[model samples]
Target: MRAFSGSRLAELCLVLLACWLCPGSALAETRVALVVGNGAYTSTAQLPNPSHDAEDVAASLKRSGFEVLQGINLRQAEMQDLTIRFARAASRADVAMFYYSGHAMQYNGVNYLMPIDAMLTDEADLKRFVRVDDIVNDLQQAKNLRILVLDSCRDNPLAETLKRSAGATRAASIGRGLSKVEAPRGTIVSFSTQSGQVAADGTGRNSPYTTAFLKHIEQPHEIGDVFRDISSDVYDSSGKTQLPELSLSIIGKFYLNGQVAMTVAPTAPQAAPQPDPCAAAEAHWKAAESIGNVSAFEDHLARFSSCSFANLAKARIEGLKQKTVLAPAADGARASGTKAFDGNYWDVTLNCPASGKAQGFTRALAATVTNGVFHAEGQNPGGSNRLEIDGQIPADGKTTLSARGTTGASAYTLNNLAPGSPYAFTIDAQFERSRGSGKRNEARACNLVFVKR
Candidate 1:
């Protein structure tokens, strides 16, 4: 055969990679992107870089095989129309991406992306802006992979003005930067900065976060890796102050440049086994334990819902909530002699007796108890099991406990019962918990013993 030229060989390699990555349907799927940049504001100080950033990103996306819809200096009505049109286009596409560069903020836990014409003088003015959730909800109707990139975390000088002009009611709602969002399945959301953090609009034509993203997005790498690279680049460029945040729930692998992943042949039969997700989940769970926050545990469960540690993560989250519930009372000066919930971890022993088609479940667990609520989880024969015991200590000295436990398909709920102590609670009901779609049923009894560690 004649020697192939270097460029010719590279082209052939790329074609082969495409075939491997897409199998037989690469040409059949469409990729669409919508880019919006709002810089020219009539009501506040004009943002100079967003329009340019959008244009550059639009061009870059077009080069990357996306049918790009780009708009600049969009008003509220124009923004709404564009999103509608974009969503329609995305409905027919295999991959949909939304890139927005502008001023955005959170008011009362709801995120609103600002338009060029927005004045936002009062809380009622929020109706004139575009809610980020609306766009997300509209895009959720799309068939395949969705990507949302927001470079809209600039601090608004107008927010303070609005707060000063409007009153405490509206002021309390206005907050710096965007709130965290839970991306739906098959979607990836990228924020220029962490939730509630402001992003720097660079001195140049683009924001620091967008600049780093543009630099590496065209490279032949997995999409996740591309974001990781963006985060690293921005952190370094911004003196480690402006770190990007990502919410990813992508079901399958996707490469930006359609590169085929390298695969090695297995050396033995056992080597071909699928990787255990529990390993990764447990590692993240351990990492989150050090942080000891609700979001940390919630993140683990979101990524690995079916993992072995899922119930434990859920219980941890509930335990944190219990602590939060009791914290306010302590801060408000509760009754004298009432001790606050101890912060120490507790070892839990649960006993769920078999009754009325439900199997017996018993396991040792670890958890944290706050006040009269105990949240714990453990692995059983079928899967992970969780137990939540809530007690209400009334002022009249009569205390009642409610316990709920779930394992696989079996669930047990014990209504108001006289519980002995905040450290331990038991349910010895006469009937078993209901099962199946519809039928009369009774809840089974459960015993939970907690020991501080």
Candidate 2:
């Protein structure tokens, strides 16, 4: 029987040769990554952990087929250069990832992603140092999956007097100016903490949460599934502390090293970002110029120093100033009666043909008018409120204030509004129950009515 079988050995050898000799049989190589860890804040607390974390994650991403570029403690110019390079890489790569761990702060409302060396002593310092949208939107245009992991929510080290005036309460709740921007399609953005929550930069060699993240990233699973495990792991490790909230509006599932998912986690939802004012200001500037309201155009530019429309605002304002023109004469001043409402000695005088509508004001919360805007002050326990303006708030642009609203708690919402009509706005910011322990309670929101004055 053995001798008979040997007669066909040449045929079997031929078959085996055919199976092993195929070309173009491998999958495309997955190129990905931009890992940034900025831990050297000159003005505030130094984050020793982020640099280590960046180094670690960068190595991990590289091992999995990422054509990695690493930047650490970059001065302003280096940071911008890296961002530009990262964007270029993303456009061609199969997958793009951005990881930043460092100090970040939000002011006037726009969030600034701070490098370790950043010191926000003056509002203008932010313009010189950090380039937020450049980094985010660049990756947005990538051909494949876009993944951003920002552990940049550390305690702002800017001197107390130099802080951005967007009312913040706890170390955890200090706004990092991230909420106003959107992670584009095919992107998954995860913060170390919730949007309004601050994550702990642990006292250990690495931040507790980030250490957990690094641990799970290499595990055999889809990135999203890995994050769920990371989220659970971090929570358990931190003794049931704040858990990470994943906000995703991804077109499809993204894989690590192109390994198709063995596990799928429920993706998070993307919050439609409130409007951007610079986006509006650019249009508004053109509108004002079209209407020949030089004065109006000039005024809008002065307040929004950091808007994406800053240059346009500056140029337009100079033109208007040189022309020395005023708004048309038909818009005469009107005198509406005065109504002053005082809460905690904060008084607002609503005068002149009312500047707009009365009922547009929200009754649910408190309100106050300062610098011609309404805000509900003292609504939260520490009096922090966030008043998002109408229209898209430019990622880095100027905002024209139409009306300001805030509760006593301190979250202020100022609409870079048009003086279309006189607005009669009212805000009642009453304190409600705490949302959770070790966290400030949510303040009430009030609507303001602006009418023609």
Candidate 3:
């Protein structure tokens, strides 16, 4: 080798040092994304912006070195297949992302993303739909970080016209917007707007949310900060009507545009800093509220121990227990032949027959009768467990009892199997009992039984 000057030797040494110090010398981790847009709906209004959103997002992700799988207007079967494939791809990825733009429904706090070919009726039959929970479960297999972005809070037209079948006692609460989601550690769930609110499809080619996302996603900043910038941009673009929310639990830094810095030497272990008691309590409280379950509340109380909202959480837990435990108990009473419908306590059990391609189903109701009005609480076999029914029981006993759904619940069509009227029941010794079933227009059969308590 030829001898070099002092300056050249120093320059060569500096270059070598830089190579050893930089993380770019090593291979970058892989980033994978699954993007789906379902705008073509068979039973509801077609969305105009979802497909465009997916395409634009995919292009941006590809530019940032993400292996993107983009799909448009996928049906239930196709959507399922795509998710399964995505799961396999994500299992080896360092960062896995899922972006969905479509119609979503929330029933009993569980969110379901509807496929393009889904014909959602009044009933909340989630067996065929892709649940958000299932998506989270699939993404949880990723080796590193996970990101879930949902821009599917558009106004749903199907929610208005969808009616629950007759003889079904409980109807699921069909809300307008998607509900809040609880994500696991190392995962972030971002929403186009706050929970229980709808988002606007902008006049431009891309939605306001997607437009903002595209603008900030490639910025050379921490990924969480990028989302914060996007949130601010969307909030302003939507005229303050929309507020994007991010539920983050990421542990380390994730840069979309560049390589992460490497720590050359290990640092000494230090005492962990104390967490702010109020802040920790609030975070737990918010999670419980989003989940809206008794177990969540109970866990919060157990962990926080002395939070300010501990009493309030306890109260909510008690109320949820009543709904969960008491309502099912009523159904159990009817099923086990311990309770019946009468003048004092009207327990009407209705079943719908399988008519014209529909399956047969049954519903049970337990109500307290006062005056001539019958106040009922019903539960469906495959639907909601908290259905409230209000009807009038005739004094003649020959007349049929017509009941309707109340409190944001769906109406039950008690169709009589025999000719004349749909309501067929008996007034035994002391109770008003109905012991016949009927069929509705749908493919399911309806049956009714009345017993006295």
Candidate 4:
């Protein structure tokens, strides 16, 4: 497969832009990628489109100078893990595209990704499973050319779940339009079917959408032309079973054909020993407990020279930085006094680090900090967090907790603390999940943030 090293993506972008000005073709290396497939669900209905779509797409991506991440039958955590990894890969890429084939639903206007083992029996489970905005936004965060392909317009599977839990007339409406906001300068989003519209399954083995996607993706066609062809092909092939949509205001030229861009940063004379960039970055990475801090993560990753947490950390940082969220480093200190947690929740921004396997899966450690007292309790490996303070934390709470290490994944419950504890706080854990979209890493455990009161 054609490869564009992270080191090269920067240099190629400039060339591609210049080539755009000229008429003829410009031979520049474009780092392209394909994230494909999402079949092998346990309880939910299996997705045929992803398995089929991934195959042709990966091959086409290879031809297009793209690296591919593939997964099948992935859980929510696993899907997010792979997606975070892909985001890191996109860091140096000039052109990044994410494609998916899976089951998705909307509830109370919130969109969710249907994981293989998703037990969507109620509305509250949304936190347990996948969030659609999370996936799309993470990809949209990539630094350069961004393209999103959503081949998931299947009929809603959680119709019963929504009706029972949400008391809504329908399961979830596939809302039209992108996030009701314009994306960065260089971005394009393509959907298999229009919002709230269902695509048809094929009479034969392959679904109509996949067949059309495979047909147009490889030809020497502009992105817009390809979409038009796929749209027409789907209508004709599946008895008009599917209708696709595109929400794009991209002003630049995006060619499936090899086109590249490059830029150079002003450099100063070499300075001696810049200190361990990783160590310096800890302050930034550990700053905000919430997810979507892509900038800090990216800054840290670029400076490291093959650290253990390199891949996962990089993905997490980029995921948060790219997403248009407020996952900044914690600025306001937790109020002093005893604080209570209301069960396990996350500050997920990116995928868990591979090192987290060693740190354990728990996101935070339960501790009691009151009146100059500090304690660490509930040190269970991947168990529920049931750490409580001696008294109720003061209402004027100030001071937060910090939990680092990718391996720590904890479930916490903080309650019934001392009545007059001066200070009580929990580390807001930010977990990260890479998109599986029928890609591998679906089985990868999603990072969790434990809370106990």
Candidate 5:
């Protein structure tokens, strides 16, 4: 090696001292990411772009000096395990990110990300799906910056099934797209489109949002500016139908390209905006209309007595009360002349067989037919599970009964389903005056037997 000049040696020594004082100065700061793309759905139509989007994003992140955990066509259990590992890695990282492109939805205002194998037959299936909030929470543990990107606003194929099973009142809470979420301080949350709107899966190899995102993510600009460019690009390219939206609470500039040093400074948080009264009333009115129940209308009237919907609420209450009175009279008339199935008391037994990854169990219930209508409600003692069965028995004594309930105990459920997940299925049954037998019509194998009590 050639001898260095005095000036050059002194400069090199100073550089070494700086590196010794600040260990990270000599090395790249730690950046970690979790990227997931689900395209091969088992129950719904497969998406065309998610797997490609994930691969492209992962490659870009790796080029940007990020350690990326990438997954494609992930199942529920695999997704959960990967997230747990990613969360652990994020806790040690300076900048952490999560990107997902898949089938996602909002149910009762909560956003859920669906895995490839997810069969979201009802709202209860949400338990098996990942919540967007959970991913945000994971990123929140990162040291400096957190970024969440969701290119999951494609039209959901499972929404109709959930709506049909949830009943009218609950169905209204199932929104068309992912719900709006407020970012925590020092974090940014991005959506492919505005809340309650759908986005197109591009005809190309990636989604429109991902296509725009990849174009600007490595453009040597601040992350905020990059996302703004992405939003604008998506808007212009989609003929103004898709407008990307973001909730950003980042305090200072963050550059993804590593071309600039990250700068974060403490800032006072802004006060939350006060809710608009008329808007709140309108939302309440919508809920009441969806419920179409006397108590729901009465509650709305109590809350907004002078609002514009007050008169409508009162009218609905009156109509509901009249219907209630008429219903009892009609039932009494039918009861006076006992029908074939009327006044029949039955003990109901439900038997579920063991399936893959799920344990089997049995349940018992009591039912009575009144005015040719069968009704039963059952609850597990000291447990959260509850079931309701109801339907009309025609003269032929064969009819389909509806069964819906909140699930309990993961071990007892199919696929080890999360507790409190909602499930609904139909039971095809033929009944005599005192005996009945039925089979559940769904993915699982379950049979019901009824005997006179």
Candidate 6:
């Protein structure tokens, strides 16, 4: 026989080791994978690493005994068809995986994967992209293990356009990268970087995350160990900037190299250790900070009332409340000199008393006037209710502030308007140096009190 090279000898040894450890195991377990790489975008900047990442990862999976379904620079329709076929193949597999490398984003707490042909100029255009939740549901059909790897978190130019077209309430919900997702039982979801943070496309042929992943995936270590190693490698290689993250709910031990036998007998499985509360709370705070909305901050406060960031969360809520917009100033007022209330912060309290078929509600909003412009926005925590106030303060300190927003719950609106119904009203009032008051003479009695803060 011809003499084998050093690398070839090592590969032969690994094959013999697998055979010696578990006979016929390679043929026993069925593995399937769906790999997609979408670059060459039509309306946005094209990525450079996804296609090479997919090709290399597919080759590696194939050598590891996976039946891989691979696609490159795929459009929306082509991607959907591949996903359908992959779902059918995964239904009969022992281990199934889905990997994508391209553009991805989150809106309204839902994650979306972008295709090459996508032109996401409006929020409604999101319907044309692929929802990550749908793909995860498809991956859940596998019998044993389900893995999802996304190396698509590079900076996306499409997100800015979507935000510009979305409503103020919905625009605040759009976020960077992918949101954190809870993995289903027996599944693991991995991202190139932590939630709300962008990942780097490497200077090499593949992304930093994918390059690190391909390095350790062929090792005979357990799956968790493999990911931990990948995370460490990425953290070190990316100058400590890109840290990989995973949501894992997998049970028992699994090795990619099919090294299943242990020298000792298996014992009862142990429960996973509890995560540190402060660390978890900080993670939640980071995600909320990225969104920069009152609802997101309020949600953080609701979950972590006593965490270290509780006061910070409250302050964020107040700041976001101050950023809302009222109606525009009249052209004559806009041309006037500096108004009396040019630099002032107002503590705005809105109280709507109970009326027939409508429940009562109260909110404290922080408003500010800069260069004679008065603008503020407020939203009900944990609900869809929103209030936008915008107008310019004239030299007389008297003007009508117009407010408009969609209703939340039916019980919270005047006359029990349906949720999501649009409504508008005006506040007629006058402001002094330190105190001001306004009243809405609508069907329901609502009053506003503004005190200089």
Best by lDDT: 5
Each candidate's root-mean-square deviation in Å? 13.4, 19.8, 13.8, 17.8, 13.8, 13.6
Q: Write the per-residue lDDT of candidate 3 for residues 1-453, one digit (tens) a residue.
A: 799998777777776765643433445677889999899888789988899999999998988878899899998899999999999998888789999988886654457898888876646456678988778877888878899999988887765555344123333245457766645678888889877688987778888899999899988777866776777688767766687756677776677785434343338886888986755765676667655678889999898767555655666677688767775554444343223334565566766555322345566777675544556666444443345544434443323333432111212222121121112121112133543232221112234555655
Q: Residue 260 lDDT in model 1?
A: 61
Q: Report the error of model 1 at residue 279, Å.
A: 9.3
Model with the higher TM-score, candidate 2 or 5: 5
lDDT of each: 0.68, 0.53, 0.67, 0.50, 0.79, 0.78
State candidate 4's TM-score.
0.48
Query: Candidate 2 lDDT (Cα, whole model)?
Result: 0.53
Candidate 4 on 62-176: residue-level lDDT in tens?
Answer: 7665667777667778877887787777766666787777776654344566667777666666676666555555565555577777777677566555566655333223232
List clashing residue pairs in candidate 1.
432-442, 432-443, 433-443, 433-444
- Lowest-sum lDDT 10-residue window in model 3: 415-424
Measured with C-alpha atoms, the lDDT of residue 141 in candidate 2 is 67
- Candidate 3 Cα deviation (angstroms), residue 428: 37
Cα-lDDT of candidate 4? 0.50
| Per-candidate total of colliding backbone pairs | 4, 78, 19, 90, 1, 6
TM-score of 1: 0.59
Q: On residues 59-160, what C-alpha lDDT tens digit does candidate 5 reach at each position? A: 998887788999999999999999999999999998999999989988755689998888877776889999887898899899999999999989987987
**Model 6, span 349-434: residue lDDT tens:** 88987754568988887788887778767777765677777676676777778776667888876435557555555676678876
Give TM per candidate.
0.59, 0.53, 0.55, 0.48, 0.55, 0.57
Q: Which one wins by TM-score: 1 or 6?
A: 1
Winner on TM-score (2 vs 4): 2
Worst 10 residues of 4 by lDDT: 434-443
Q: Between the candidate structures 5 and 6, which one is better when assessed by TM-score? A: 6
Worst 10 residues of 5 by lDDT: 257-266
How many times do residue backbones clash in model 6?
Answer: 6
Mark the regions of model 2 whose C-alpha exceeds 4 Å error after superposition. Answer: 1-29, 164-182, 257-453
The full ranking of all candidates by lDDT, starting with the best, is: 5, 6, 1, 3, 2, 4
